[model samples]
Structures are given as C-alpha cells and as structure tokens.
Target chain A: MEKAGWDGFEIGAMLRTFDGAIQNIATTLPEDRAYSQSSSFTASVADWRIEKPLFNKDYCIDCQFCWVFCPDMSIISRDKKMIGIDFDHCKGCGICVEVCPTNPKSLLMFPEQKDEESALVEWPKKVKKEKEDEVGEE
Target chain B: MSEIKKIKNLKEFSTSADRFEGANLLCPGCAHSIIVREVLNATNDDLILAASTGCLEVCTAVYPYTSWDASWIHIGFENGSTAVAGAEAMYKALKTKGRLKQPDRVPKFVAFGGDGATYDIGFQWISGCFERGHNMMYVCLDNEVYANTGGQRSSSTPIGASATTTPAGSVSYGEKKNKKDMVAIMAAHGAPYVAQVAPNKWKDMVAKIQKGFAAEGPVFINAMSACTTEWKFAPEDTIAISDLATDSLVFPLYEIINGTELNITYRPKNIIPVRDYLGAQGRFKHLFKKEYSYLIDEWQTRVDAKWEQLQRREEARV
Candidate 1:
C-alpha cells in the first residue's frame, strides 16, 4: 500500500474537520476576544461602568450561573475553578449579583467608585485623549 | 382617532403609588413599562417576582430606585427559572411551615427577563421549571436582541436583522440565522398556558397577563417589545413601531393554550408588507438593498407560512 500523499479528498476532509474544530473553539471562545481579529475594539463611556458581581466566594457552589448568563460574555473561568470578571466587557449591570443563588448571595453589586480603573488596557486613543482633556479642564 | 380610544376612567385606572414606582428600570417607551403596568394592575396579591438581569433589571434595580411594586428579587439573567423556582420552593416551604402570612392563597411568583436571558441563557432553567410544574408566569420581553449590552444579537434576533455582533458590513451578512422558535419550544414543554402579545396593544397585553397568572402550572409570555436604543429609532416612535409590527403581521398577537389550541387575538384590518415593518427600523436597513433583499423575502415567506399555519390551527379548533 502506497503511503497517501495530500490528495484532494483527504485534504478536503482534513480541511472540513479543521473548520469544524475551529468553529467549536470559536463558539467556546469569549465573544469579545472571538471577534477581536476582525473588529477593532472601540472603548465607549459605558465601559467605565462598575458592573462586577459581588461574589462571596464562600457561598459559590461553582454552578457557573454568572459565567453562563453574562450577556457581554465577560466572565472567565480560571484554572483554579474560580470565576473572574473581564471588566473590559462587563457593563457592570449587576446581573451576577442578582443571579447568585448562594445563601448569603455569593455575588453582589459594588457601588461605583472613582478609584477603580477599568481592566481594558487598550482604552481607545480618542476616548483617552477626551478623558485627559476633561481632567485638564477640571 | 376612532381606532385609538382614550382609556376611560383614568382615576380608576390609576395604579398603586407604592408599587412599581422605584422598582422598574426601563427606558422611556420601553415595553417593560407596559408589562410591569399589566402585572401590577392585574393582581394586588403579595407576589414574589424573580427578575432576570437585562435592561429591565438594570434600569429598575439600579442602586436604591426600585420600580418593582411587589416583592421583587433581582436574579441573574440565566437563572430566572431557577431563582423563581427557588422563590416558589421557599414560598411553598414557608406556607407549609406556617411562616407565610397567607397560607391558603399562595403568593404569585412571576419571572421576568429579556430575550437574551429567556430564550438563550435561561432556556435550560426555564425548561426545568416547566418540567417540574412550577406555579409561575415566565415573562420574556422579546426585544429580539441583547439590548442592554449595546444591542448584541441574541438567539431571538430575527433573520436579516443587524446587531452589534451581526453588523451588516462588507465582511459579513446580517444575522444569517432564523430566530429560535421560543414559543414552540415552550409549547413543546407542555406548558399549560403560552401567549405572545405586543406591548403596544395595552388591553390585550393586560388581559393576557391576567389570564397567565390565573393558570395553574407554568405560563410563558413572549412579549414583543420595542427597543428604541437597540433599534436605533426615535424614542417617540416606540409605540408607532410596535403598532406597525402587528399591522404588518411581522408579529401576530395571539395566545396558545395547553400547547395545542391557537387563538389569534387581533388580526390587522389590512395586512401590510413586511417591508413596511422592516423600513420602520434601522436594524433592518441592509435588507432594502439587492443582495439581502432575497433573504428578507425568504424571511417574510417564513413569517407568512407561520401565520398561515396558526390560522389553520385556529380554524381546525372552530
């Protein structure tokens, strides 16, 4: 039996499977990051809102409600089984706080405070410049 | 002027000042207002509400200002079913334990959320609740997208519609998928009561809500809501746009009973083209062009087919 070279049928099958694998990966990947390659991330004023769920780590059963229900797809499951918020995409809508079914309410909302900086490192240059101008005026 | 009659007895129609004043967080012209009003108007019974996080939750329960008049709990988006389920369990347990004030009359429990939370995120939990036969009304404000988060597309986004994620740009077509048949899915679960009402039609909406609560088991209401922010339409046009939806037969106002019986509440006098409805909203602007026009036509055909099927069902019953 001759060892098969990269024939059209074999290559096509491989490519099809490869596409499926990519799709599976793409679906599981975070929505914000999934489109990062194609769409430029524009930082708006809404990004600054403090919408993190106040998680009482003690009561969390790791049900992953917050992670799954996050509309922005901002919550990330860390290796240690801990779920963290991707503040960049999180609108701080307190959805996590509302959904936490823990006895003491594992996730709660934190009041908007001035000191907390957003996790989104690459703030849009125009928005950043606008902020600087506002600060200068102040 | 003849069609649009002013609601008589404004004084009698006045809702409780205490209820829904601070709890609701809906924008002006939002359909959430209509739903909230309907629920509040229907029953004064001590009700436990489980609100799934979305536009409704964000606006109503933002910090201290709560528009919810009844006892409300803001649960996360997906677990509306679970949370309401939990609330029902707690309410039942309390009744049995003699802790609940009105043991004979159990507190009504209603779970409310937007399309994203209900159709997509909370589907499993909702199914669980229905399967377990929870005494609750699951109200899904079907605004068609995740309107709260800058208009991202949800499973409920109509085919050929534009959203933040499904932008109709050069790189991609509009939402290349059909809306998940949420009403059918709910009906399949053997829900005792299922209804779809447009928020613009206040009387029909109010009546359905009242009927839904009176139901024994789980009742699912897919409310066709107007999303001014997401639709990129003027806030003032919210009512007009919602009215146009039903007029165009894009969203037929109807109720389904016991998953089998079909009852269409209000059919428009003159069924307008789907284009009239689509033209009203900016989200569907791409469909007017040549390439996407065929796609829009296909979608309209699907809508017409569904409407015909519904009509046949209604006729068979008669």
Candidate 2:
C-alpha cells in the first residue's frame, strides 16, 4: 500500500516522553512492528540504590577497570580519566568500589543521603591493599 | 576471516558512542548489560540484534522504554535462531532487490539467547539454524539459570548449585545432574567458528566477537554471564566471580575454529582452587558441608579432567 522504499523503510516516529504514571488510564503503548529508539535515559533508577560510590580523583589510576566492569554505564569519563559517577543513573551497586584496584580505593560507597562534601571530610582512612603481583595490564 | 584491527588503547577502542542509553532494568551487577555494551562497542559495522526473551530483553525493553540504541528485535525465548535466520534472509533479499538504503552497506546479524533459551527450550531450533548455515552468529549468554522467571534451574546449572527449582536440602543435593557441555554441542554442529568467552576479559571477548562476525557461515559463542541476583553474589563481586570461574577451569575461555582447531585462548597462570569459585557464591554454599564436601572434590576432578582433555586436543591439532 506504500511506495517501494528502494532504500529502506523508515518509521520516523520516535518516543521521547518517558513520563508515565500507573493509573487506570491506558498510557503509551509499544507500537506493533514500529521501530523506536530507547527512551530509558529518561527513567531514573537512582531511587533503587541504597548507597552510591563516591569518587576521589586523587587515587584513581585511570586504568578503566571500573569503567569496563560497570554493568550500568554510570561511570562518566573523558580521555580515559574518570571524571565522576553518573549519580542519576547509578544504582549504587558498589561495583566501582570493589574494582577500585591496588591503590587506595579511588571509589567508596557512602549512604545516599550523605552529602559528598561532608562525606569527604570524614572519609575513611587509607585502607591500602597489599599490591599483589600485577593482576591486569591495560 | 576479517582483518582484526589491533586494539592499542582501551581509551580509544571504546570511544564510540555508548550503544545503551540511560539505564533500563537489569540488576546493578548483572553481567548481561555490560557484555551487551562491550560487544556493541567493539564491532565496527552495523549489527542487527535479535534478543531472546530473557534478562537482557526484559530488563532493557520495558515496553515503551528501552536502553538499546542499536537496531534490536525481541523474538521471544523459544526461537532466536529462526528469528535471526529470517532477519538475515530479509537483509539479503533487500540487498539483491536494490532496496538497501546504502548499496555498499552490509549489516551483520547477531542473536542473543539466554542459557535457558539455548540449552533447554530452543535447542532444536538452534540445531536447525546451525544445519541451515545462515550468515549470522548465535550467542548464548550462559548464566546457568533461568534468571528472568525468578531463577529456576536450567541445563547449564552446575551440580550442587541451588536454584528455585533445584533446592539443596537433606533430601536433595542441589542439581543432581552436571552442567551441560554447550560449547561442545555447538561445535558438534560443525560450525566454522565456536567459542566460550567470559566478558570479564574484555580484550579476549572483543577479539572472539570480531572473528565470529567475520566468519562466512554460522557461528556460535557461549559467553559466561554472571547473575548478581540469582547467583547470590555481591553486585561488586560479579567480575571477581567470573574471573574465578575461568581460573578454576569451571568456565574455560577458548575457541574452536572450523569445528576442528582447538585453541585455548586464555590459560590461568596459576590455577586457583575450585573452592574459591564455589565459595564466592551463595548457590554453592551447601556444597561445603561435611555431607557434600565430596561434591567439591568431584567438581575439582571433573575440571582437571576437562582441562587435560582440552590440552590434549590443542596438542593433537599439530
């Protein structure tokens, strides 16, 4: 019923609105056979987390260990150096903390309610891990 | 085979835009999302992904909201192989009819199937796909359990690992049967390329994926996927557990080329005890008890035997 798309079929309709309430009213429904880009960026999983990892740039090795291991793309980085964590999307899994590597952990989990500035002031003392034989090379 | 571009730097290798936009609903430490992102990032061409209904599909695709940024399709749990073949067929037909938007463009096809989908329900469909020899890759994200429906035991679940359906108790010893040899079965299909990968080793995984894509015919890759929720390990310990699995030879990383050449890609410098791998997770906790201590020994013996067999096979190729 449509002209032969000699190149390809383009479903120009893309959904950007992610605000959906669980009400009696039927909200946005996924269209049948219609292509749409993911709108999950609009959904926040921050509330699902109980604690968030706090980053200390001074201790980071820029090895990208945390970045590679992060299941969620919450580790924000540029030019290999981790700038900060994407708090809005981070689920406080503390994976960054576990993978912080040989140096004094660059990242540590803190209560979500605690402010970073205050948390930094009383930051836990250096718990240096005994550097084992080189575990991983870049 | 396609020329593999050497990855000189990790920073530059993944400079491509993130394929996953925002967070969907995968658990904090689930390896499915990380593996998907890494696979998407490493490749250089457009890929049409067919996702089986599992953790990756359910979590990423929450109806109107999805985290996927690539051309993705959900084809249910029963027949990912058939869906992928159909998609590739469509792509070829469109190309021949001069309907392709880009004349020079060729989209590689990849189908992601959960362990349950591949091993339990969709085995025959996959076998048929392998026989048909479609120009596509079938990847089994083997997390060893039916993770989507609250962690039921699948064929891939290791002995002594408890799942919702296979409870470890005085009357029972977790899963009575051993984990199925999925890679061997896939290789038996005579696929030109077959591999077992653990995404924790990103470099190895990337290389294997590139090779799989480059292969001319059907290929199968069984990638180890660690489930933080069902596996009962801390979210942070996901990579650690996966690494341990490799070192303990519970999940060896290797590739079978032309279904005959045996290449063990990564070998442990120092083999870690099987206990370290078992103890790291809650599902295998019962295996440590006095009554079930023998199970650990059996696991170790089995692992050692398998490792030896792999080494022998690698030697035989010469």
Candidate 2 residue-wise lDDT, A23-134, digit = tens: 2111111221122333676567999899889988777778787887788888876666777888768988877788777356778888889898897777666665665623
Instruction: Report the lDDT tens digits of candidate 2 across residue range B67-122.
Output: 76556777678787789889998888998898987756566788898999999999
lDDT measured at residue A3 in model 2 versus the true structure, 0 to 100: 29
Per-model TM-score (chain A alone): 0.49, 0.64
For residues B181-281, write the lDDT of model 1, one tens digit per residue: 89888988888899888766666776787778778899999988878778867544565677778888888888888888889999889887777788778
The 10-residue segment of model 1 chain B with minimum total lDDT is B1-10
For every candidate in turn, the CA RMSD to the true structure comes to 19.5, 7.6
How much is the lDDT of residue B281 in candidate 1? 83
- Candidate closest to the true structure, highest TM-score: 2
User: How high is the lDDT of residue A50 in model 2?
Assistant: 92
TM-scores of the candidates in the order shown: 0.66, 0.88
Stretches of candidate 1 off by over 4 Å are: A1-138, B1-12, B15-18, B22-25
Candidate 2 residue runs with Cα over 4 Å from true position: A1-38, A124-138, B1-6
Error of 1 at A105 (Å): 50
